[model samples]
Target chain A: MPQVNMTVNGKPASGDVEGRTLLVEFLRETLDLTGTHVGCDTSQCGACVVHVDGKAVKACTMFAAEADGAEVLTIEGVAAPDGTLDPVQEAFHQHHGLQCGFCTPGMVMSAKALLAENPTPTEAEVRDYLEGNICRCTGYHNIVKAIMAASGQDVSKIAAE
Target chain B: MYAFDIERPTTLADAVKLLAASDENQALGGGQTLIPTLKQRLAMPEVLVSLTAIDEIKGISEDDEGRLCIGAATTHAEVAAGAGKYPALAALAGNIGDPAVRNRGTIGGSLANNDPSACYPAAALGSGAIIVTNTREIAADDYFEGMFATVLDEGEIITEVKFPVPEKAAYMKFEQPASRFALVGAFVAKYADGVRVAVTGASEEGVFRWSEAEAALGSNFSPDAIERLSLSGDGMISDLHGSGEYRAHLVGVMTKRAVAAAG
Candidate 1:
């Protein structure tokens, strides 16, 4: 077993994990950060999406050992340390972005990653970015609205068009 | 998941040495494909030589001959961002398995895996890229042998890939909604020497060049040049998603769309 070390949610986190231990497993099982979900095992579903070194990556696809010494940001760490919600999380709440709530964390984390890379993405761009994050509920209409609203777009006109 | 020893080598020489030493060791790339395979127990290697630590094979640059040289370990995100001169290849990389997969998946992994539906092999073969390994440089024509197969040796590590800049190029992919793998993807590249057309996802033998369409479009770089050259359904893949005839038809459609979209 390799003892991996990384900064998770702005704090030092380490664990003795197997070589096959996925980063998601480390977050959920070892660190007890259950906000990150595992919707699919095939890596098609982005439920395990989180920011590694400020970039969007599937937590299930990377071994915890691979992310050693890296900075990780999950849905749990997206907000301010003072419990204030990140703008994207706030938008999701305000716009009714999720229904099942299973894909919300991954969606929020991936959305933040997208916004970090591209501040103001177009509607098509948002849709394309969230392709990996599958939400069975909400039909993705509200999710798209939340991402757009997070980018400082008007949601009132979103429905009219 | 099977327990395996993970070896992180900072140098390519170390990686090769580790791989050569182990009887059942695998090279680890972006882990987009390898990790999933590990989780599924499809592949159980005794050791894994991670190429992530080697910084040498991790950038996109142009060589003296104006060819785009992409390091094997360079993530798809880097390729999408850095390959500004190769818009078709960039676009192909940008849309591969969404943003997360792009962030982790590498061109070398995609090329080496040679998933029949993957986008990179199409771009590499279409642009007439050179697949560079630790031992030798293999042409795109020879590198791709079949599905999930390449000309790489057991201990060979892909260092970088070299691609010639074409006069005009574009990739058109009709994606499978669930997996984002191309149902049928076509990459068309027109150069001073000639035109190359590569098709992926529809073939059983893996990515292949559409030489008939290429020959047609070589003289006339227009959609109409290959409009009547629909490929036969002999070796086209037939699955629940689509039949062989349908995929063959899509190949023609994608080729024409690629030709029209090229520069």
Candidate 2:
């Protein structure tokens, strides 16, 4: 087993992981960070999305050993140390972005990454960027609105939930 | 996925040595496809050699000949950002899978896998790119064999790919929404010499060049020239998503769209 070391959520995390142990497994099992859901073990569902070196990546598709010595950010890290939700999470809460909440964590993580890259993304850009993250409830309209509102855009004129 | 030992080699030489030490050691690139395949137990390698840490093969540069030289380990996102010299190639790389997938998947892995529905093979074949490996450089023409196949030898690693910038080129993919794999994708590149048309996802034999359409567009560089040239359904792939006839029809439609878009 390879002992993987990474800075997760501003803290150092180390664990002995098998070659087949996915990053999602290491986060959920070893670190007890179950907030990163694994909607699909396959890479299709981006529910396991997390920030690896400031870029959003599907944790399920990457081995724990592959992210060795990297900086990771998970859903659990999205909230401030003071217990305040991140702007993206707050927007999702206000806009009813999630239904079952299974995909919320991944959605928030992916939305953060998108905003970092393109601060003022259009509604089309938000929809396109969320292509990898699947929302089973088909609750994409609110999700898009939340992402847009998180970018400080007005979602009031947009369709209501 | 089965249990295995992974070695992350920082240098290409070390990676080659590690792969040579064990014939069962497989080179892992982006893991976009390999990891999923491993999860399904489709491939069982004794050891996995990761090529991501190798800085030698992880950037995009242009040679003196104005050709785009992309390191094999360069991620699709890197290519999407750096290959602005080749707009068509950049667009193809940018639209691969999605943003997160593009961030992790590499052009080298995509080319090495040569999935029948992949978009890179079409771009490479159409642009006549040179695939640079650890030992030798192989033209895209001789590199791909068929679906899920390539000419890569055991323990071989692709180091870089060189693409000659064409005067005009574009890739239009009709994606199979579920997998985002190209159901029918066409790449058209027109150079000073002639035009090249490569089609993917539709053929069972893998990515192929439509010579008749190329010749038609060589004289008249427009969609109208190749509009009358119909592709045959003999070797087209027929699955639940589409029939051979449907794919064959798409080949023409996509090629025309690519030509128009390139113009």
Candidate 3:
């Protein structure tokens, strides 16, 4: 087993993991930070998205050793220290962005990454950025709205509809 | 996934040395394609040499000749954001797999793996890129041998790729909606000397240049030039998404679209 060291959610963490262990497995099983979900083993689904060194990446597709000595931000780390939700999460809550909640964490993480890159993306950009993150329950209409609203846009009619 | 010892090397020489020491070793790029294959138990290697840590082969810059020199470990995300000088190449990188996949996949890995549907091959071959390896530089025509194959020898690692800047170029791909891999992808580049047109996802022998179309488009440089020219379905790929004839048709359509879009 290889001992891996990384900063997870602003905290230093170490775990003994096999070379075959995926980053998502180490995060959820070793550290018990289970907010990051795994929807598909094939890497097509974006449920295991997490930010490694400020860039969003699919955790399931990377080995645990790959994140060694790196800064990792998971869904559990998205909120402020004072317990306030991230603007993306808040927008999701306000806009009814999720149904069944299976895909919300990955969606929020992906959305946050998108906004961080482009703070004021247009509706089409939001849709294009969300191409990897799939949401079967809400049909993605509200997810797009929530992302736009998080960017300070007035998605009122979209939310109402 | 089968268990394997992973070695991370900080320098290109060290990576080459590590790879040379192992008889059964695989080089890892961003691991977008390799990891999935590992997860499916499709490949098993004694040692995994990770190229991500090597600093020498990990940046994008232009050479003295104004060619775009991209490091082997450079991720698609970096290329998409940084390769603006080559807009067609950048656009192709930006549209690969998805956001996450783009962030983790690399040009070196894509070229080495040489998936028939991979986009980078078409870009490299279409633009007549020079494939720089640890040993020597290989022309793009000689770099790619066939589907899932390249001219790289055992323990030979790609260091960088140098692409000559073209006057105009574009890539057009019709994707399989679910997988996002190209159903039929075409890349066309026009230089002062000649035009190069490469098609991926349509050929069973892998990414190949449509010389006939290229020859026709070189003189006229218009959709009308290839109107009478037709691609045969003899070697085109046929899968669940489409038949060989359909893909052959798409190759023609995509070529014309790429020509129009290049300008």
Top of the candidates by DockQ:
2
Q: Report the lDDT of model 3 for residue A134.
A: 84
DockQ of 2: 0.89
Which regions in candidate 3 have their CA more than 4 angstroms from the true location? none
> Which digits, one per residue and each the tens of the lDDT, describe model 2 over residues A25-63?
999999999999999888998999999999999999999
lDDT of each: 0.91, 0.94, 0.93
Clashing pairs for predicted structure model 3, backbone only: none
**How does residue B89 of candidate 2 score in lDDT?**
96
User: By the DockQ metric, which is better: model 1 or model 2?
Assistant: 2
DockQ of each: 0.84, 0.89, 0.83
Backbone clashes in model 1, listed as residue pairs: none
Which regions of candidate 1 deviate over 4 angstroms?
none
Pairs with steric clashes in candidate 2: none
lDDT of 2 at A86: 96
Q: How does chain A of every candidate compare to the true chain A by TM-score? A: 0.97, 0.97, 0.97
- On lDDT, the leading prediction is 2
Ranking of candidates on DockQ, top first: 2, 1, 3
